[model samples]
Target: MPELTMVQAVNHALRDEMRADDEVVVLGEDVGLNGGVFRCTADLFEEFGEDRVIDTPLSESGIIGAAIGMAMYGLRPVPEIQFSDFIWPAFDQITSELAKMRYRSAGQFTCPLVIRTPYGGGIRGGHYHSQSPEAYFTHTPGLVVVVPSDPYDAKGLLRSAIQSEDPVLFLEPKRIYRSPKMEVPDDDYTVEIGKAAVRREGTDFTITCYGAMVPVALEACKKAAEKGWEGEVLDLRTLLPLDTDALIDSVTKTGRMLVLQEAPKFCGYGSELCAIVAEKAIDVLEAPIKRVAGFDVPFPYTLEHVYMPHADRVLRGIEEMMDY
Candidate 1:
């Protein structure tokens, strides 16, 4: 095993997948020649050639539409939407067509594709590049939303997503893309989707989060520990088809819950998580569930730190839950 950054792990996964399956093709703006905006697909153009590693026009809808067509024709297409904020142009293709192909065709057709996009605040990408839009896709009926926190899971989950016989929305947090290297296996492996990983074990309370917010939640737990409260940290790597069983188990033991997210609070993913706990495991909770999330307003340029949920906000939410 070797330590690799999230971006490096992503590149490794693409290379490995391309080698293993001829059906796997990479397509998106600057993904081929330019190696993607973040270099997640670097050197792939030379290795796989122009036919396999395609560089598409500057149309998000066209990119997704072409990918959907390719998938229908039995090719595994991994299309990268340069930024999650710019993905709206292809929303109809994703929600209406890509997500509904299997159900609409009564299992006669399946969209074996992955839409990779950089998401979340931090790194000062402002509103145009840093929006967290996983909730919208997660609400769709047939889509699988996955957000990996570290490099290890980033590679494994991506491999799993590409291999699955369904459309997967793979949201990569741009904040820590090049930071925090983690040991990842060089062999073939896949992280099971729809499973929540308990990063840290504790009994005082449980902090559930995913993507960039996972690190913030862990930091909040560390802060809590310093104040004599050991908070368990649960990373919902797979957002849609959430691992509620894992969530309930941890909340049941901790008797308190704090859900965190970089997305806005109103009708956000954290609210859905909190609602699930309130419905299924409310009896086991010692206090009301708390949710720490970005404000409802649009992501601001100058107030990046204020807009995104941080360790201090999560710690405050945890303390509020405990005191309640």
Candidate 2:
């Protein structure tokens, strides 16, 4: 086992996929030689050659649009958006063309591509580079959204995302790219997407989160345990086909839930989880389902700490729910 950062883990996945499948290709800004702005693709071009690891022009729309054509021709194209903030320009290609191509073709065509981008705050990227856009793609049918918390999940889920039959929007937490480190398995293993993991299990209360927010929730739980509160923390590794059963079960067991996230509160993934908890496990709740999320305003220039959901905020939600 080797302790790898989020960036290194993702790099491993892409390298493994490209080696395993000749049809696999990666295209994005500086992906060929510079290894991406974050170096997630560092050295991929040198190994796989320029034809496979392409350095595309600075055009998100063109990258995604061209990827769709490649997939239609039976190639698995992985396109990278330097930042989630820049993906809006290619939103049409994703939501309209790539997403519908598979269904519209009715078994005639499949656009099995992965749009990988880094998201979330804690890097002082202000509004643009710090945003979490998973909710946007999750809203659009036919697109799968994945947000992995740690190094292990990063490598595994990216492998699964690349091989997934549907077009996947893979969001890596930029903040955790270099911060958190964990032992990744030596051999190849892809974590099945759309499954939520119970990071810390307890019956007191459940705090559910994904991506970098998982660490916050776990830290809050650790603190709560010292004060005699055993909090259950669930990491929703895959945001799209959410493991609603695990969520409902955890909430039902604890009879309390506080959905924590880095994304803004308005119509975010937390909203969907909250609604699901209400609909499926309302009778099991001891109190109203609570949320600890970023403020609905744009990410601040200097108040990044205040804007993001922190350990205190998560603990506060726990206190509120347990008190109620």
Candidate 3:
């Protein structure tokens, strides 16, 4: 076992997959020589050389279009989109072409590809750079959307994504890229997609979240413990194909639920979680499902602290749910 950050774990997964399978290729801007903008692909170019690691022009649509072609031809391509905020430029290619490959072809063709992109706010990235557009893709059919909150899951989920036959959107939370180092196994392992992990267990309430908000929820649970409110933190690592069983179980046990996300609250991912609980576990609910999320506004550059959900804000939401 070795201690690694999320970024290092991502690089390790890419290296391991590329070594195990020659078909696994990495292509994106600065991913070859520059080691990627976040260094997630550091040193891969020197080892694999040009054919396996390619640097492309600054075009999201072109990058994705080429990767789709490679995938359809039997090569497992992992294309980097730099940031989730820039993914819209290639939305048509992803949602229309990439997503519809298997269905449109009636099982005759499948696109085995992973689109890697850093997402969410926490590094002062303004409106252009800091946006959580996960809801858009999660709503789409035939695509797997994954978000890892720690290095351990980051390595495993990425490996699983590369091995998946279906196209995957791997969203890496840029905030915890380097922090929260953990001991990750050097051997091959994988965290199954579409499963949620219970980061903390409690009996009073459940705090459901994913990606960067997982840590924030955990912190709020810690603070709530001091106030005699035992909180459970459920990390929904995979947004699409959500682990509905785990979600319903947690809410049923605690009898209260709080959904959190860095995205805007208006029609955000949290809304779906709330709806799921309301639809399936309404009878067991003791109180209204509370939500603490980013404001329904553009990601601000200056007031990020206020716009984004924090531990204090989450604690308040917990208190309200508990009191109700």
Candidate 4:
């Protein structure tokens, strides 16, 4: 077991999948020659060849549209949008075409595609380069949205995304792409989609978070422990088909909840969690299910530190919940 960065784990998933299945191909701007802006696809062009590792123009719509077409023709096309902010141009292709193809065609057609994009702030990517758009895809039917918190899950989940029959949105947190590494097993492994990973267990309270906020939540958990409080951290790897049972169990035991997310406050995935908690475990709650999230406004460049939910905000919410 050798530790590898998140980028390396993703690269291994793509390479292994392509080697195993001839239909697997990757296409995105600079994915061929430049190896992607973050070099997430470095050396893929040479190893997979230009045909399998194709590069396209700046049109996000065109890249996604073509991938949809390729999937319909029985190819597993993995496309990248460079950044999550730039994926809007392909909204119709993803929501209308890719999402509804199987249902609209009555199983006559299918789009087995993976759209990978780096999302969330932390690298000072500003509004254009940094934004969490998973909630958008989660709202659309027939799309699988996934976000991995670490390299091991990154590799396993990407492999699962590539092999799934339905279209998948693979959201990677670019900020941790190279900073975090783990000794992922050498053998083949595929983390099941729609599962939540419990990073730490405690009975005092449950702090459920995802993506870029996971490490922050972990830090908050450590702080809570030092102050004589116990908290559990749930890493929601899959946005859709969330592990409701795990969520319910943790909250039922702790009798308190705080949902953490990097996305904006309004209409965020956090809202859905709030509803689910209230519905399933209202009686078990000692306090309202609080949420710490980014402000509703567009991600601000200069004030991003305050815009995105921080560890302090999370702890404050937790402390309030405990007092209640």
Candidate 5:
């Protein structure tokens, strides 16, 4: 019933969950008094107080490791990594310990932890602050990777991630953290995980993307429409356990496909989508699957525009697909 930015919606979700659930606790660097570097946790510290909302040291591994421990014991912990580029320090803790808990214990225990982090380039954050590393966690066995494109999905998907019985990697696209505003319901609701939303419908082709690239894909679709190329755009709210059914269904009707991501082209989430289409929906394809993604290089500070896949670049890829 109100319009809010992605970051504001995230704050709403966190506050609502904390109020409804006593076990829900939030902790990270500068998350309490500072209210997070991006201020997504703004006012939360004052509302929830110190015990429920805590500020930890600058150790990424300690933040995640402690969250895992808290989840293992009876608390539902939501730990923020500040930035995704800094998440690698906790890779072992996430992959080896948090991800393997339920599987290793044969369901004797579960890690209901939400590892929240701001990710992606476009804010001139350069290499250290802006990077899309969702692919790494998607490859892990016992983790659910979620990326919401807009305010509504951000609130809903985050609520689902917090309530899920399994470990979740919640990557918020920092690039569009506060720009666009969309209507989000005030009442509590959860968007189902592992489902993709069809943003724009078309019959010529389909553009599959997630996170900040969702807006890029939509813009590409609009550009293509001017040329009479009606392309469907699929916003994959969840990356891991991808909604293969939605992808195949759209490709089946459109007969052309393009997968996009802000991460590097090689081994990125786009690659996985291409592979799935080739394996399951190739027969319906009118053209080879195309991938429009960030180049296989470190994100450049000066040339941030070139490092991100924008509408123009995506339109070029669509042209190539059409020509091929």
Candidate 6:
């Protein structure tokens, strides 16, 4: 095992997978010669050559449309959308065609496609580049939504996504791409999709979060620990087929819940988690479920800190829930 950043871990996964399987091809704008805007695909072009590591046009729709065609024919295509904000142009192709391919064909075909894109705020990208539109795709039935919080999960979950038969939207949090280095195995491994990880265990309350917010939640839990309050932090790695059992168990044990996310509060992914607890574990709740999230406004370039939730904001929510 060797220490690697999230970006390096993702690159290693891509390189390893492409070596292990010839059908695994990477296609996206600047992914080849540029090694991707974030350099997640660094050196892949030189190692695998043009056919495997392809540099695509600027059109997001074309990138995904071509990948879907490749998937239909038996090649596992991993298309990279430079940013999640730019993915809307390919939304129709993903939701209508990529997602429904298997069901529509009555099992005749499957889209083993992984659409990887950098998402969320932390780098001060304005409205055009920092949006978190995961809620839109999570609502779709056929797609799998995955967000990795650290380098370890980044590599493992990506391997699993590439191997999955269903179309996967692998959202990488750009904020912690280079930080939080961790020891990751050189050999292949897969983190099962649809499962959440309990990052911290505590008895007082449960804090549910994922992606960029995972670090915030962990930091908040640390602050609470110093105040003689224990907080359990649950990282919801896979969003679509949520780990409902783990969520309910944590809430049931702690008797209080606070959902954290970088997205807006209204109809955000946190709302779904809150609703799930309210529906299934209402009897175990000692206090009403609360959420600390981004403001219901466009992601601002200057006011990025004010718009997104921080450890203090999360700690305040925890205190309120504890006092209630």
Top-lDDT structure, candidate number: 3
Q: Write the per-residue lDDT of candidate 3 for residues 65-106, one digit (tens) a residue.
A: 999999999999999999999998899999999999999999
RMSD to native for every prediction?
Answer: 0.8, 0.9, 0.7, 0.9, 0.8, 0.7
Q: Please, what are the lDDT tens digits per residue for candidate 5 over residues 1-324?
A: 899999999999999999999999999999999899899899999998999999998999999999988999989999999999999999999999999999989988889989999999999998899899988989998999999999999999999999999899999999999989999999999999999999999999999999999999999989998998999999989998889999999999999999899899999888888888889878898888888989999998999997899999999989988888
Q: TM-score of model 6 relative to the true fold?
A: 0.99
Each model's number of backbone clashes?
0, 0, 0, 0, 0, 0
Ten residues in sequence with the least summed lDDT for candidate 4: 179-188
Q: Which 10-residue window of candidate 5 scores lowest in summed lDDT?
A: 280-289
Q: Which lDDT tens digits does candidate 2 get at residues 1-324?
A: 789999999999999999999999999988888999999999998999989999888999999999999998999999999999999999999999888887898869989999999998999999888998888888988888899999999999999999899889999999999977899986889999989999999999998899999989999999888889899999999888889889988998898889888888889889999898888888999998898899989888699999998898888888888888
User: What lDDT tens digits, residue by residue, belong to model 1 across residues 1-324?
Assistant: 799999999999999999999999999999998999999999999999999999999999999999999999999999999999999999999999999999999998889999999999998988799899998999999999999999999999999999999899999999989999999999999999999999999999998888888889888889999999999999999988889899999999999988888898899988888888889888998888888889999899998988889899888988898788
Task: Name the Cα RMSD for model 6.
Answer: 0.7
Compared with the true structure, all predictions reach lDDT values of 0.93, 0.91, 0.95, 0.91, 0.93, 0.94
Q: Give candidate 2's whole-model lDDT.
A: 0.91
Better of 4 and 5 by lDDT: 5
TM-score of each predicted structure versus truth: 0.99, 0.98, 0.99, 0.98, 0.99, 0.99
Please report, as a residue range, the 10-residue window in candidate 6 with the lowest summed lDDT. Answer: 272-281
Error of 6 at 205 (Å): 0.6
Q: What is candidate 4's lDDT per residue for 156-259, written digit by digit as tens? A: 99999999998999999987899778988877899999899999998889998888899999888888888898999989899887899988989999888999
Residues 1-324 of candidate 6: C-alpha lDDT, one tens digit per residue: 799999999999999999999999999999998999999999999999999999987999999999999999999999999999999999999999988999999989889999999999989899978989999998888999999999999999999999999999999999999998999999888899999999999999999999989999999999999999999999999998899999999999999999999998899988999888888889999998888999999899999989989999999999999889
Show model 4 residue runs off by greater than 4 Å: none
C-alpha-based local distance difference test score of model 3: 0.95
Return the lDDT, model 5, position 297.
Answer: 96
